[model samples]
Target: MEKVLLFFTAASALTAVSSLPARSFYFVYEPKNWTEAQSYCREKYTDLATIESMEDVDILDNMKDLSQMVYPSDSYRAWFGLYDDVSSWRWSMSDSDFYQHDEKEFRNWRPGQPDNYQGNESCSAMYSDGSWTDVGCSYSTRSVCFDVKGPNSTFVLVNTYMNWTEAQSYCREHHTDLASVRNEAENQKVKELIPSTGINWIGLYRDTWKWSDGSSSSFRYWRGLEPNDNMEHCAAIYFQDSGRWEDWNCDKKNAFICQNGFSQKVVKLKLINTSSVDLNDPQVLENLLKQLKQKLKDQGVDGDIRLSWKKQSDGNIFMKNTEDIGSDRDVP
Candidate 1:
């Protein structure tokens, strides 16, 4: 009987193995502006550095070599991934079902408003005239809350003054969520709830900083009085200040840090088929892959594992072995 030698390869998918670190940081001494550094990182690695926690900060702090970098104006700073996204406005109630069509993108900003004054105004507030403006999230103000019952919704004004986050919490605990003004009508409805001269908190808000790799990490380690300027939208790590973060102009050239995640590993496997089943048959090959995946899972292999058969030049996944049949074993 001819022995079919099944050759296949397995690769790691999007999720890396649990034992491996999520990201590895690299400090590049070459001076490049923030945009240039970002492009380089995306081309060579995953993206510019995305510091997720204090541990990541420490890792980067130790990896930086000040002697290798050229001091630009005696500044001991290096660009990382955090950047201000000035147009990322969204509602606090993020459930897609709550909005219709472009209602999610609805805005009633006052003219020349939402300028993100001082680079710290990341929250939205509605005035008595039904216009919205971005304000600092820490500003205490009365908030408008909403209660939804089926398709009907009603706005309520919370008389107690609180910060944006506190108001969101209060509204969530007491009502459906903070008021989401979906249209001119809803904006007017919410505006009516506020006092004629009051600026009240609404569900509209925007994230000031975002990671280059699109990671939603809220971790921040800023130096005192840092990120105080609206023009300085890019973030950098200050080696001289114990690796604390500071905002800078993106156009300024500086040494930068990049991060990389675990790469996909291609593994070759050879299987000796002893049964009479057609090993190259599409259904048979698919079943075999499922069984192999289960076997790997049973043997403690984790993460997203993807298996595919590598067809030879003749377009066949399995070839008849001329040598003596041997026990099943992986080729590499």
Candidate 2:
């Protein structure tokens, strides 16, 4: 015996169940200048999107129902985080760490691509699958968002002598914000990277008459003759020097200096006035003794402080000291 099962039911159920990729829908924002596009993506989705492969670029290239936002440029190409200028090759718009992102091959650049276009063009775009183009840094265009899963960041080392405002503008031109000191250790390290005579612009700027990091300008240590809002509006600290910070105008152009290393061993002390001396006599026995002790402390010493003194013709005395920590402050 054979049995046949038949159903006479028909609806649009199969047609309504259309197929879709697991991650297909990508949101497209309106065209914008490179800076604005970068800011928008960071605020909404992620840092400026970085396409890891030709396949990834192709995925974005295939989007159909594109719309515009922010700027009203009719240009079809949009900015992505890829550039090959020998001047500034890294992504200019992100503070996010780039070291962690899995390095991707540049498979989309045309043959002999990114020759830097007479050493000027430092920006890149994805025109279509297996196609990429370089554009001027200021050209406006739409930008894409990425569903970045891992850590994506960048580090900036500012080596300019500008007032805070000027430093910021410079960073913006390169698609980065002013440098921010995240911690006390980082601040110390920054100070050490600068010179003693000139101020190197860090992220700190003068908010009104007070020096400030964008987050907090109220709290700061101003160097002598600094926070000179009229002349200087930027700030920098010398390596291992214990004076403070200074402010300078952002526009004044000057060369900057920097150094990198592990946490600098610092020696902290309180200067106690044991005796009084005349204003003119900085090397008098009373003043000389106290000053020498302080100088020795600054050279990184505490217990069994030993120093050799030298008297100069200008009535100034300098001291050299050596120190070794031997357990307790009360031991000696």
Candidate 3:
């Protein structure tokens, strides 16, 4: 009863341990500007590192140890994923469903919209009749919610008046976040859901930081007096400054990090009762993926995994006109 397990051989012991697939960072020593570094990464590896959370930053910081040892003659300020977008309109919700086939870039704004009127109109809202406008985030208003990836493409219009931030919290808790109108069709649906009356908050906002690979991760890690919002500037991590992020001119050349492998895994599963819920809905597909991720973690797997649908060739999340089998694509 008192005996304890022991590792007889290092190789066998290493083989028995199961850890989540990690997004590893590779330090490239050659000097290149932001765009050139990105090209190099896409050609050889995956893409530029999209640091989503402190964990990602920590991983890069750990890699800094080896970077120091190997490239002592080089500068540690390397390029990551943050960049200055020519446009300021960004989605507040980071869900990938909005991204299927460049749908996220689709906009149904009224002419001269996102006017950033008064400089504080950072949040977006849609008129009950279907056009969108940017307004002050403090303005309280009703909001639309799309239960995408649910029983149906459920669009719920919450009548309670709340500011944009509060509306976001309410919608996220009840259904998904504030409605994300992907295209004209989806925008029409949202318009129909809300009365042809008051303004309703949607999931659009303005921000300068965007990912190189078109990811919408809103995570930011910056150093002292950083992100001065300089026009046309890009981001790089200063290794000497504790691996903190800094905004610099895009033309400045520096050695950078390349993340080559996908943090996602695609697994197909067959199921019954296909009519219970519309798995084709992005929100529903995302929720099911989350459940599967939790199930995996419950079985002693890593909890850092995120789940989403692996779109089919036709840019749909679920395979239609086929048996009820689906793919569980994990996001790191």
Candidate 4:
């Protein structure tokens, strides 16, 4: 894939642009099954709410007030964002770019792994420097978290014992959930975070887990014994339990959580600034960004494409070296 650089016009570059709206979810109380509810949500708000992390789940958990005020129905149960397709195995980190490279798909599973032990082992764990093994989603274990803050990556070793869902919640609440080791370097970084004793949870699971909006989010909050029978095809947040997910009959409609859509398309473009000012200057760059944004809006590109400066390894927004971002120049 080639990197793109956009040409900025000096004549009409400083035009005003519309602001991006804050995404929000709405709970529809109409009595409908999972499929019907999904369709309804698609027709009205965004698709069935896609819970990205524990924080997303938290928003769904607190939707009761909104539901009562808006819906005013006495229904207790509802579907939020999970369903099983009985397809092939998939990662919890469903980002395609994360695995675009050949080495990023590396999986060092233990021998005889992913046996789907008892037909419900959908979660995974890693201990010491050992390979991974599939485990029941309900099993309690320590967890590893990955944080992509600025240029420095931080991995947190959470020793607290909790089921896969709880551990994911903890990770999202504190750091990014079970590290998505893109390559060997990331895998080793997360591996070092885990102590030698107990098994720790990693961001890996299978179940054809999908979001309502047809988005691929590799995060699953399934209970230990899940996807047991393909008969119970739809997924729901077991509010009665610990907010872990459970497979239920699609026809059994419960109060479902709806969330705003944050679907984004990443576009790599090569752009050129027509202005004579320094593009590296902070204020100057900001104005250039605004002009680019407005120009994109004028061309109907709009808020979907956000214009921002990329940070360097040393956490600087603008690199001191005059090397192309896609070049093979090494920075230390």
Candidate 5:
């Protein structure tokens, strides 16, 4: 009987499922304010539901019990986990080293500007006079690009008119990135580079809406003129309005949704067996699985991990290699 040494091979087949947690939404008919609902969900399940796509919206719509959602008017709603983050504004140039202390907070916005006109203005533009204003990202305009070397930076005005996204791409490809007006001096330098007449796109932008569980989904299914009120900071799905989203006051009590589940991952492993003991034996395989699981835990791998052997066409997990007598193969 030859001694068998088991080792993992480099060509092992490995499959990884998405790390995002699999969630199941539960509709709680009990009316509760946004804050209370959030607390209940956190204590009972994972957190308030974070709908990421139209498919998720449909799921919620199907699961909701409209008869239980009693109200005086025809409108019926349920709170999920979307909210307006009033202080989410920031510059597109994210490199922290490029900005000095308090430079990132510097703002020279024109008065009564950045009202998020109609809840669509998420990009920033610079006037020839050196003031900034929030505008729709789709609006085409001339842009300023900047190049940075060590502690020095140079601002260049792009003569071509383009949307904010296009301008950002052009700037990144040709120069460093869109010009970041860190302070009054940098703002003045960028403003001087612009033509004396028209407004130009800048590096400032923001995403006002966020999920309670901190999901970074940009999906929005708002109804017409929805999110129109600035005072209504929280979001809900209106059942009567074809499940479209609407901004509502956070204090308003309503039924809510909660979600639960852990993220799952799948991995395939191949082992080279050099032991005299049969690797395919049920007792031996179970012991090997236990050892592998313990090893994973010892290495600080969190969450539940399941291990099982992969059976071949002959229903055996371990196969002898006659051509390569030096090694036997086991799939798991």
Candidate 6:
């Protein structure tokens, strides 16, 4: 009997230790800039911490169980649990589910909080008083952690710069629709979908293409010649395109596309501002040429940066550089 009791005690202690969340689990120990930190946390740790209720806050707090709850010594800063100043509070990561407030006992607001100071702040933080304060997305601080929702999670694909009908067709054919960015975290995740290069279409187009869930196109990313007559009511996004969204007519067709497939490459590279602005700026041109040369060299291609600009041709600019377009050759 004595031996069995001792064995039981040892088993219980081991279970407790195994269950205890590591402080390192709360954040990646390596310090990084705000953007890099967010990126690191997303790429390495689980998505930045998301809170569903006060229970989640408590879980995250408990993540620091073994270590002292030390104040951030780097600066007067801390990561928080809110974003986008709207009624919707989102996690910094895109995959996090939208937080739903239920119990009255688990308030996460900072005193005099969520003031929407200048309407630009889209993140939240906690203060010494345990209240949450509005902060900038670029602010660096320790982050909370969260896991992706599930295994069979459905992924949506979008077509940036597509007509509403074409966008709908693309979604139907690909088994998804123009993705609804529910909150900042989702927006953040969408932003992380690809490398920064060109324009990405968002699921936000005027008043049409509203999902069955009531998400609106209130948020917009319009292309240069957009609205094309108020009928261009659908939206889509691509990754290589700097995540900048654009609106398009539902009937007009464009090639820009996006996908959530495991093997699909959904980013579209756009030379939106590749124009050499400094005609006389040697350094700027040199740097641009170097970067461009590196990009070409990295791909191990013999392609050249083709430049096409007619001098004073009715104030119009037309350029073409498509040596690797659709050749199964990636342009780095």
- TM-score of candidate 3 relative to the true fold: 0.46
Q: Against the hidden true structure, what lDDT does model 6 obtain?
A: 0.33
Off by over 4 Å in 4: 1-20, 65-75, 88-207, 214-219, 263-309, 313-332
For model 6, the superposed segments whose C-alpha errors exceed 4 Å read 1-85, 92-106, 146-332
Top TM-score prediction, candidate number: 1
Lowest-sum lDDT 10-residue window in model 2: 8-17
All candidates' lDDT scores? 0.78, 0.34, 0.68, 0.63, 0.78, 0.33
Q: Give model 6's TM-score versus the native structure.
A: 0.20
Tens digits of per-residue lDDT for model 3, 53-102: 88888788877643443344336688877786646676655545436767
Instruction: Give lDDT: candidate 6, residue 152.
Output: 26
- lDDT tens digits, residues 1-332, model 4? 12224433212232222334555878766667798888777667666787677877676667654334232332345687677654444444443333556655577787877566655777778868857887888998888877754434577888779988777667766774556666677777877778888788887776545665644466787778775754676887765455678778887756677665464433332344444545456776676576667766776542255556555577544433354522221110
Stretches off by above 4 angstroms in model 1 are 1-22, 53-55, 71-74, 262-332
TM-score of each: 0.69, 0.21, 0.46, 0.41, 0.67, 0.20
Candidate 3 residue pairs in clash (backbone atoms < 3 Å): 46-260, 148-283, 148-284, 149-281, 149-283, 149-284
Q: How accurate is candidate 2 locally (lDDT)?
A: 0.34
Candidate 2 off by > 4 Å: 1-25, 66-74, 84-117, 120-332
lDDT of 5 at 297: 77
- Candidate 5 stretches with Cα past 4 Å from truth are 1-22, 53-55, 72-74, 218-220, 224-231, 263-332
Candidate 4 lDDT score relative to the true structure: 0.63
Question: 286, model 3: CA deviation in Å?
Answer: 21
lDDT of 1 by residue, 1-332 (tens): 34444433222221122333457788888889999999999889778988877988888888888887657463678999999888888777765555787888788899998888888898889989999988999999999999987666899999898999999888887887888888888888887678988789998888678888655567999999988865888999989888999989898889999987743333445556767878768887677677667866876654565667667689777687776433121111
Cα deviation of 178, candidate 3, in Å = 5.0
